[model samples]
Target: MTELHIRAATPEDLDTVLAFWKVAAEGTSISDDSGGVERLVARDPEALILAERGGELAGTVIAGFDGWRCHLYRLAVHPDHRRQGIASALLAAAEERFVRLGGRRADAMVLTRNETAHQAWGAAGYGPEEQWRRWVKPLTDQVCSAARPDCSG
Candidate 1:
């Protein structure tokens, strides 16, 4: 196995990362588009970490920290690179970033149906929080109406 190189992704990496996710990642996300990822890279250049082996993308992990919370997402290892410590390497880089940024705890969004991921995360010292549930609403450009007072223009 070749040496693994970990680094922060740049604008040039957005397209490649998007394409890689389709093949390596477990599921799709609302923010999987180029625009969304571009915004992420722009907001925090170090948030998207990539692991490359012999110049080929081997794994990726988004270690986003919104000042108060550390959120991990899109942890994907190439099918050919599984069980080779790629995920662990990417996560170590992510955790190191979070700690440097003053983040206390890191949380990951793992799909409930992805049993393989459950085991991986569990082995990485992450477990499901039974008391907390995730709730989300996709933001859109549609104008807010009087009936939906919760939405603002």
Candidate 2:
């Protein structure tokens, strides 16, 4: 395995970052979106760290922190770059960043079917929340309008 230098992603690296997600064979909900990549870079480059092996993008992980808890998502290592410790390194960096910002804990939402991701998260000190499960539902414009009222949220 080559030395993977983890660093903040830049606009120039968006293509490679999105490309990695594009070629992922299976096991994630990340889409190949150019607009989304640029939006992330505009918000916080550190949240979208890129792993490079001798200047080539090998892996990426999007770590978002909301002042209290850190959320890790979109962790994707190129198929060719799997098993090289890149994902682990990226995770370590994310935790460090979260702790530095006074975060209490880190969280990640992996697909229930992705055993590989489950193992990686477990090895990184994340355990399955048998007592709790984070649930989310996408809201469309119609749903959003239906839920809105003159004095209610």
Candidate 3:
């Protein structure tokens, strides 16, 4: 087993990270692109964390802190690397970042249907808030709008 190196992602790692998510991550996000990830790394350099082993990307987690809250996303580990503590290592680093940023609590957006993730998060001391539901409204016209029908401006 190769030693896992956990560290912040660099600009050069953008394409590799995006590609890694396509294979390892359970689902895709609207912002799962080069431009979006580039902006994220540009604005918040430390937000995207990566776990590499023997020069290959093994896992990733986005530990985003916005003033008062620590919001985690994109916790993914390669299929070949499951149960090897890659996810755990990324999370430990994320939690440490949150605490250092004066954050009181940390929250992760996990897909409800991903039972495997639920178990892993539970083991990491996180619990679901069953009463809360996510409500979202896209800010840009690129998002499909039923009422307008033509979102392409």
Candidate 4:
């Protein structure tokens, strides 16, 4: 196996990143399109981090800092490359980024039903925030019915 290298994603990497997430990630997001990713990279070039080995993508993590808080998303490792510390490497890079940006706390949006991912986050020293709930409103009809009054499926 080739040595793992972690680095910030470039504009040219957007398509590859999207494709990688479809296979490696647990769930999908409304903003997972090319346009959304392009906007993200344009706004914050250092937010999206990637792990590569022998020119193949091994893992990905998005470390977004919105002035006061650090938000992590899409922390995915390819199944073939699991248990090889790729996730840890990506997270280390993210944490380092957060610290450099004056971010005191980091929060990740992990799926509740993903038990394996829960264990991974736990192993990485992150505990679940039982008191907190994620309230969301999808802007796109593809994810939620914007035409409906309550947006219920």
Distance from true location, Cα of 88 in model 1, Å: 0.5
Score residue 93 of candidate 3 by CA lDDT.
100
Runs in model 1 with CA error above 4 Å?
141-153
Expressed as tens digits, the lDDT of each residue in 1-153 for candidate 2 is 567798888898888776677675234342336776788788777788878898788888888886767888878788888888888999988888888888888888777777888887898789888788765453432231333321111
Order by lDDT, highest first = 4, 1, 3, 2
Per-candidate clashes, comma-separated: 0, 0, 0, 0
TM-score order of candidates, top first: 4, 3, 1, 2
Clash-forming residue pairs, model 1: none
Give the TM-score of each candidate.
0.91, 0.82, 0.91, 0.92
Candidate 3 regions off by >4 Å? 141-153
Predicted structure with the largest lDDT when compared to the true one: 4
Better of 2 and 4 by lDDT: 4
Q: Residue 39 in model 3: shift from native, Å?
A: 1.1
State which candidate, 1 or 2, has the greater TM-score: 1
Candidate 1 lDDT, 14-105, residue by residue in tens? 99999999899986776778888999999999999999999988899999999999999999999999999999999999999999999999
lDDT of 4 by residue, 1-153 (tens): 789999999999999999998899987776788988999999999999999999999999999999999999999999999999999999999999999999999999988888999999999999999999888766665665434332221
Q: Please give the lDDT score for candidate 2.
A: 0.74
For candidate 2, list the clashing residue pairs, or say none: none
